[model samples]
Target chain A: MINRHKNLREKKGNFWEERLGLRAIINFLRQKKVPLSEHTIWLYTGSLILLFLAVQVITGIVLALYYKPTVAEAHASVRRIMTEIPLGWIIRSVHFWSATGMIATVFVHMISIWLLKSYRRPRELTWMTGVFLLIITLGFGFSGYLLPWDSLSLAATKVGTDIPRVIPLIGGWISKFLRGGEDVGADTLTRFYLFHICLLPLMIFLLIGFHIFLIQKLGISHPLKYEMRGIKVPEIPFWPDFVLREARVWLIALGVLITVAIFFPRSLGPQADLMAPTPAGIKPEWYFLFLFQTLKLFPSQIIFISGETLAILIILLFLGLFFFLPLIDNQPARKKGKIITAISVIIIIYAIAMTIWSLFE
Target chain B: MKFKYSCLSRRRFLSWLGGGWLATFVCSLIYPLFKAITPPYREPDEVVLLIKEVIELQPNSVKYFSWGIKPGILKRNDDGQLIAFVGVCTHLDCNVQYLPEKRKFFCACHEGWYDENGLNIAGPPPKPLRRLFVYEESDHLIIRREEKA
Candidate 1:
């Protein structure tokens, strides 16, 4: 059977294949190989992210059909979808869970790449694009959260938008722009709905397309340490072997998503009242917990600069460093590279610790 | 005696079963997706209103209400008669505004116009504004889809 499949291209004057010349693309995929190692499992995380994203897009479209962008009807519309529309709760639940899954997978993929030092010299652009994609994914989460127009969502968005106000010169303008006014009200809902359903999707789609294209063109990166030591990595064809393994992973993920969505569906809170005081324990989504906690830990003022401003500046500094990391540690075999990796590990630990503390508090 | 079914090997059978399971799983999602995408049925056959809401409505003026998800208008004709209209434009679905000076229902969307009597008189409106029968009782008014015979 294997031999017959191998001889297919050589033997056939297949009509469609001849006309379209898809043979080149097919041959490229067949020739493309993935490095088989203990760390190969991390490579599968990208495909998992893709799977969750596809789930998000499909469910999101179905949701938008029922969702109302206006402040007057957004909450009521969501309620109607939950209680009145058939299986609407399931669709919404899946959308929410899939978003969580996608963001989680994205974090895993990035951290694994960092640990393996796969974002070295030739793959700098790949790492940059990955960081951009991460930001876009988070943006999707943040914007989508406000669409429900529940008290919790409104309060969280209020705090989230205010974070930008701590920036230096353009801070006030940025905050106003994000909120579409001085407050998180009617215009904010309209703006967030636009971002969630249209702008963010377009940006993510284009970036994901380019990100995948870069990945395929450069081929999968080998572990930096392994490459430096001249180790021969075992490999398997991406077309059949790697693809079949990924398909199994996708099936398992889908099953888990459906089960969790059904059993632990997200619940909507009371409709947001602009005149009401913010509900207590107001927190952003889980992904933003660490940052939220970090911001909370800062004092009201820090000498000349405000505490929140200082914190935001520091966060921005770290983000800049993270984006330009490949250039900083251009040579992964050096002592500087080891130090950078160690710092990244510490950052991860800090983030986890902060997230847990915030959850408890 | 041992008998073997050559046409159905155990490996092939299991593969077929796996494929069938996957196919079934995919097919199961279709109904929920269809239900979600296809909006709920909400054709408003009639709506009821308090007479006091429109009691002070002046002639050549319009009072707005909701007909299901669409805008509705209750206008008092100059001759002291009440007329109700589904305020959506016939060309598209933009809400029509009553221009008192012109005394015509105007859709800002495409400059579509309907006469005071709800007749399509100008612009892109292919049909007249939908008229609903308004019935006045003791203290309430009922707007129905059918006109009085």
Candidate 2:
């Protein structure tokens, strides 16, 4: 049978060879294991992120068909789509909430992986790529929010873009680049539209491709405790068992998306009037709420150093630690999951508390 | 390695079923986006009034109909003459309404009002109501744009 298969492979070359390649792949999957534990549920977070991303891509592309990116046309076009187009509101709402959903799943997925200590050893690049994905996803959010050109979106965007200006040396340049000059205007719209629809999408797609490739290359990591105990655990086949489970979860997520869209259709605020005083209660989208609130808490200056600058720099420092996590946790003589656990706990608490505080405030 | 998958597992069947639903959802979503991209419909150039007869329209009565995407009103005064006006309030472009009780067209936005003659009476409407050409042809009233009103 092997000889016959080899002969057919030789005769048909690459095409037939590919047909016979399934067994090798199947055997690899069959040999591979993702250990089952009480913690196995967290494994679905990555797939959930992928599913939400699929939602964003589909709805976003559809939205692009009707959305005009220019300052004059943008708000009216969104209004036109909502009022005139058939079920366009639902698509827009789904796109909006799905973005929130995507960011959330990313947060959960990152924190879960960190708590699991999955960034150890061979998964270092996976973590790095994931960090990139997280940042790009936020980039997606910030840029997309301004596309509607609403009063509230405009106010929040001003606050968001102003953050990079506090970075000192390249601060003004970064702000200028983001806003396309001195301030947010028509040029800012064009720049953000390019970033939202063009550059950020490209970057996230590449990063996601690399991240998933790495995940598959080095299969899902078991918790540190699982490794420490040297306990043998049975794992189901990745192709059928795990994939079907993921599919089931995706269905649930879809139902959730539909429910949210039906009950809470996203609203378009009045067109941005830059000449008017900014609205009093304008806040950034929920994902940025934590940072938004943190910045709000800063004093004007701490002993001549801008307190806002200090707060931003401190956050950047933590981000740096997260970026170089694999080296810090894995490269040393002693593998330090304990330090990771402590940091993860602090980050989670800070994020949730700040998020809730921002909501109330 | 030999492969044997003669039996269809329950999970596999469920996955396929769920996958089928997702595929349907995606298609339903994408088709509408495609449909929405077409040029927004314009109402016929001339809206021939089929619902009400000119005889049925008593003096001081109002009739409303859509002209393309714009809202229009045909107000018949005590003289039994028809006066047609675009219902858009000039201030913020909100749709104005015929408030026969007040004997004026009232804009809820900024409390702007136009008198029965389509002249701005109260508040922030900078211009008078726009007039549309109205003529009766063979027992049917048709509305068309006046080239210069």
Candidate 3:
């Protein structure tokens, strides 16, 4: 019986091999090895992010099946999905939690890569691609937030999209393009819906593919200290060993996601009344709280320039520097790298403190 | 202490467990997609307000009514004739409030304004408020979508 089962499997495998030449790819996967170290756990976050992205894509498709992107029907449709559609609440909740999970993992992945100084030497492009991916993921979150057309989302989107208007030349145009007009209305809803579903997904897919290709081309980075000490790290094959470990991590992440989604399903706010006063103490999504707080810290005006414009310019400058971090810190074992690492730590702490402070306020 | 099961080794058991989870996961993904794609039947677009509801609307005054998912304004002109307009701003669809004293409609959002006849008058309103065809039946006032000429 076992022999028959094995023969059947081999026959099916051969049939596919004959048609599509998957052998070379399989062999490549078999040859790939992951360096196991004390920091190996951080490597799991990369795949965890991929897993959550898969979840987001699947659940988002399910949501788009029922979501109506219009001023009148958007809120009502979300309500219906929550209350009427079979198991739709679960799908929507999963999508929500998956987005949150994905963004969180991206932050972790980026931070770990930064702290480990893995973006040193030839891995600069990989780090840059990863940063771009993070930005695109945030864009996905921001765009998706407004799709529900609830009062909170409406208000938050109004504030969020207005941030870009602080730039000097194209700011107004950027805001206009984002809103599709002067205000967040039906056009904004349709535009954000298109962005969340189509443009961002397309960009992320291409970028993620390229990012993975680069990661493959230049294998995963080892810790700077490990390299400096010349400590040989043990390696395991990617085909079965690392893949199995990664699969286990994915299972745990999935379990947590499901539990959270099921327990604290997202609730729909009342439909947005465009003319009604903005809700008091309105807040953006948790991931944006730090930026939100920072924006709030600036007064209306500062010297000659508007506080907001200054804040936005400063943020943009930092972001530009962050993107080119690999070029900035050329030596991983030197004083410059230590300073950059200290700066990164300070930024993380500031972000966390700001997020907490914003939550309280 | 070393006894092994004849039907299920550790490898076979683990594979079975993984396969079971994989099957469950795939089904979970498929179930929501299947349930969501089958479109829900929606009610036909029709809203009729009873005449008595708006009968008390004084001349040169406006009363609010539900026009499907949107709001509508039923205005009684100084001539005591009834005209209805969709209470949504043309500039950027906000609920417009009628000012009986001013005999005009005001959109708080973007400060858009429309005249008593729903014509764009001031502020950022580029076009007039949408006018609905108001038909008086024996007992009801039916508001229908305006036909483009």
Candidate 4:
């Protein structure tokens, strides 16, 4: 019976191969290899991000079934989901945790790839696409934050959306456009809702698909040290070996996500009140704290220009330098690469310091 | 020669397929962005601008409030009529404030000024402040920007 089953499977495989070149595709995948190194731990961050995104998508879909986007119904629907729907709180909590996890892991993955010089040579497009993915992920966070329509989120959204009004030209229009007129009202809610769930997902799906295709085509980049030494390194096949290793990471990430979701379910704040003054100490999300702190350092005006505008532009320029690193330093040099690594380290340290200080402040 | 021809044709077929998919996806993505930027303009059910407690506000007092999505001002005139205008200055679009003592609206950004009736009174304001049509209920004021002629 086992021999007969094998024969049947062989026949089916042959049928697909004959029509669709299935065997060729499988062979290509089998031949793919990822280098084994101490840096393998960093490699896991990519898969960790993917795992969190999967969790986010699944839980987000489930939550959306019950979540309302209108200001009047949004808070109430969230409350009902937490208190009434079976396991809805866990689902929502998991989604929240997964979003934070995705952002953290994606940021780390980008920096790792940047430090590793993975954005070099044939992978320039890959680097640009990754930058875009990071932007979209932040967009996801910003848009999703207001879904609950809680007072804290509403105030944060108001301040967050208002930041763009400081830009030189078209600034006011940009803010008004984002809020769907003048303020965060029903129009703003619907816009953010559509952005978080629909437009962003569509963009991310396309970008991620292309990103993966580029990585698969280019293969992962060797560490700069190995390249500098011109040393031969060992590698493991992508399927069954590299893939199985990623599964282990996914399992660990899932465990932590579930543990957090179960132990500390997400909080629902009070309903939004437009008339009341914003509650004090209204800090933005952790990822944005660095920028928020930076903005605070600027004066109201800078030599006839809006100081906030100038500060934001400078920050944008700093980020743009990182985004275009591949093009900036193509044909990599050890000295330049080291400088970049040092800068990345400093940025990370500065970000952590700013986040903690903002919390205390 | 025949093999080369077949290879070219196969590659062309794949190109066509990929291009078709790309075009469809691009159109789908761009549509929503257009939708999002263009705010929906459904006619409001009742264009009432109830500022709550018309009598409580002393006459000649300017009450600043939101008229729907726009910042608005409602002043209880000495004659007991409530006059309303959009709070945005006609120049630079900076928010204007009412200096009731001066009986004028002021824009601090560039020194633009308007009279209590929303006519530009001084300082680089090329146009008058936009007037809003409003009616008074027993204790509230109603604004109808699109009030019929």
For candidate 3, state the interface root-mean-square deviation in angstroms to 1 decimal: 1.7
Q: What is the lDDT of residue A203 in candidate 1?
A: 94
DockQ of predictions, in order shown: 0.48, 0.24, 0.34, 0.01
User: By lDDT, who's the top model here?
Assistant: 1
Tens digits of lDDT, candidate 3, A71-145: 989999998889888888998999999999999999999999989989999999999998899999999999999
Candidate order by lDDT, decreasing, is: 1, 3, 2, 4
lDDT string for model 3 (B6-48, tens) is 7778799899998998999979757767887776665325468
Q: Please identify model 4 stretches exceeding 4 Å from their true place.
A: A1-22, B1-149
Better of 3 and 4 by DockQ: 3
Q: Residue B122: error of model 4 in Å? A: 82
**Number of clashes in model 4?**
1
- Alpha-carbon interface RMSD for all candidates, in angstroms: 1.1, 2.1, 1.7, 13.4
The CAPRI-style docking tier of model 3 reads acceptable
- Weakest 10 consecutive residues of candidate 4 chain A by summed lDDT: A329-338
Each candidate: RMSD to true structure? 7.0, 13.3, 14.0, 19.6
Clashing residue pairs in candidate 4 are B49-B142
lDDT winner between candidates 1 and 4: 1
lDDT of 1 by residue, A154-246 (tens): 888998899999888999999999899998889999999999988999999999999999999999998776788999899999998899999
